[model samples]
Target chain A: MNEVIELLQSHRSIRKFTDQKIPRDLFLELIRAGQSAATSNHVQAYSIIHVRNQANREKIAELAGGQKYIADCSDFLVFCGDMKRPTDSAERAGADVIRGMTEQFLVASVDTALMAQNVVIAAESAGLGICYIGGIRNNPAEISELLKLPEHVFPVFGLCLGYPDQDPNVKPRLPVESILKEDYYREDEAMVDGFDETMRDYYGQRTGGTKDTNWSKQLSPLFNAKLRPHMREFLVKRGFELK
Target chain B: MNEVIELLQSHRSIRKFTDQKIPRDLFLELIRAGQSAATSNHVQAYSIIHVRNQANREKIAELAGGQKYIADCSDFLVFCGDMKRPTDSAERAGADVIRGMTEQFLVASVDTALMAQNVVIAAESAGLGICYIGGIRNNPAEISELLKLPEHVFPVFGLCLGYPDQDPNVKPRLPVESILKEDYYREDEAMVDGFDETMRDYYGQRTGGTKDTNWSKQLSPLFNAKLRPHMREFLVKRGFELK
Candidate 1:
């Protein structure tokens, strides 16, 4: 396998970081790499807010379910799904633009994600470590206000970037058969069962046999209760009416 | 810059492809690389349907706004945001799982995009070309039935992968100052105006001086009217109620 593929395959989310900070030039280069990602219709409906203030970073960390890494990381970034800039530009070009639609939300969110993935890949390639902080959604409104995000824009997720101080194992994924269908969707109970066992072993080994749960059991918290119930209202208030 | 950064910076959507077919092993490797992408909570809530049947490919091509590249590419994949498997597995593992919520929808969609971007990077590194088809939303209900997608699972986007027969110029993006904000969000009207001029020149040059419209003008169609109005209902029917 080539270096790029190898780098991709060896991916892991890094939480603990050293004191080293990324150079300004290199950080800008990483954002440039992110911009090179494929955007739907070239709309580029996304933005990244670098949380440079220590007080703001700490506040954000608290808001994001106490993910202290947000405060500790060398750099913290909040990636926002932005539709305002494009729509406003279109309006200036003489189009009576509709403000919010379901597709707009999907496009902006997907656009943000695609670009962020490119940033992650670029960071990893430069021997940096990274972790995705989806906990930002736990308190989206506060995060948005703190970031000064305007209407028609919402914070999708946060990312922590720094040099690694701890190395975590690459997490296991569901088997190929379970995810890759031939032409249509097909249920694979057997493969799911097999993967559960694989994950059971992985968690046991990774956690020194203390945490004994499979992938399925582990997902209970995410689904047993309504997750981030405020997201719909938050998104709508942010101008993603989903109409 | 490193090879990975260079590969990322040089990305261009290739709509024309050679007759060369990707080997099965290499394609599987690409999917494996996709699996390595970071998923929200390790939910891995995504699936990929490889549409190899010519008739199905052609139908999907028509469904996706007559993008002939869907039919012409050596391999076409429909990336799905699947919440069914994980929910089912979690239920089977003794959790009373909720069916649909806005967060679930966001997670599934973002998960699919993250995985797909990795596949794109891996494919490009191997000298392959890819185009993401968001037009699938135009007829999502029909496409879902055609692919036999179950409830709690929906097609996010389609990807056309193949060896390139045409070399398109890399599309330009908005200036970094506009997209990357420091500490808080800041508007960059000047940057946007400058980018419009850049896009005007790009469109003219790429189309041999026939296309004179800038980025803002090109976005008129997307915002001037209700876009894919059926998507909200279609997603609701597919069990992503966005509640």
Candidate 2:
């Protein structure tokens, strides 16, 4: 396999990072790579903040569900979905601007996400490790306040980057057949059942002993748990009409 | 700059692609990269289908608003938010499988998108160019029927990838300040004004001495006219209870 393929196939989330500061130029290059991603209709409705200050990183780590790895990483970036940029531009251009509910918000979130993922790959290719911190949304208001985000902008996620200090095991995924459908999307019962062994092996690989639980066993509670309740109201409060 | 940074910083959507086939090993690498992306709590709620059959690609292209590039590309991939896999697993485990209209759906969508971006980066790193086809959602019913997508899965987008047959200018993006916030999300009007020259330069460069318009002018109608109407209902029908 080609070098790029090898890199992609071997990618694992690096949680522990060495205290090496990513060079300023490489940091800029990471953002540049992110900016090069495709935006909806080329509107580019996203922005990223490279949080390098130790104090700020510490605060962010606390904000992102007290994850120390966030603060410990050399580079911490917050990706935001922004609508105000274009609206402001339209206002400045003396043109009528009408954006609400659907594409405006969706485009920004998706665009930001795409750009962030590009940063992840680029960082990885640069021999850096990255872990995305979606837990930032757990306290969106605080994140916005900390980042000074405007009403039309909200944090989609945070990314921590640095050289890997520890090598995490490759997390298992559901079978491609379970996820990939051909000419139409259909559920495969057998594929889902087979995913149990993979999940069990993944858990066993993570720890010496198996958890003895399948994917559904681990995830079923999450549906009725704390993660779902606040997300909708949080999005609404962040000014995404979500209509 | 390192090679990876250059690859990312110079990224552009290639709408025109050669008809050569992507190597199977490279395809496997791209899919693995897609699988490597972080999922919401590792639920990994996404899947993709590689459409190599030319006739099927043509039909998808026709269904997706006559974007000939979809059919002409070496490979066309459809990314989907898959809840069925987990739901079916839950059913097998004798747990009540509820597809709530909440964060689960959003997580699935975001997860699918995150994986798609990884695939895009992997493809690009392998010297392939890609164009994301958001037009797939233009007629979701036909795409669903053609792809045999089940109820709990929604087609987020499609991607056309191959060697580039054309070299498009690097699309310009808003300045960092326009989107990035400092402490809290706040809109700095001056920063946006500073970007007008940048936008104008991008427009001029893109048009090659022909007529050109600023970003806002070009994108407003696309949001208001073409995509706004059908997306909400389409999403709802796809088992997203947008309560």
Write down the lDDT of every candidate, Cα atoms only: 0.93, 0.76
Top DockQ prediction, candidate number: 1
Q: Name the lDDT value of residue A163 in candidate 1.
A: 99
Per-residue lDDT tens digits of candidate 1, residues A1-243? Answer: 778999999999999999999999989989999999999888999999999999999999999999999999999999999999999989999999997798899999999999999999999999999999999999999999999999999999999999999988898888887899999999977898999899999989988999989988999888999999999999999989999
Q: Weakest 10 consecutive residues, lDDT, candidate 1 chain A?
A: A169-178
How many Å off is the CA of B188 in candidate 1?
Answer: 1.4
**DockQ-derived CAPRI band for the predicted complex in model 2:** medium
- Per-model TM against the reference: 0.99, 0.92
- What local lDDT score does residue B25 receive in model 2, on the 0 to 100 scale? 72
Could you tell me how far off, in angstroms, the CA of residue A15 lies in candidate 2 after the best superposition?
Answer: 2.0
lDDT by residue for model 2 over A53-169, one digit each (tens)? Answer: 778789889877789999888878888887777666665566565655654566677788888887887888889998888888778777777777767777788888999999877
Cα lDDT tens digits, model 1, B1-243, are 888999999999999999999998888889999999999998999999999889999999999989999999999999999999999988999999997899999999999999999999999999999999998988999999999999999999999999999998888999998999999999977898999999999988888999989989999888999988888999999988899
Which candidate's TM-score is highest?
Answer: 1
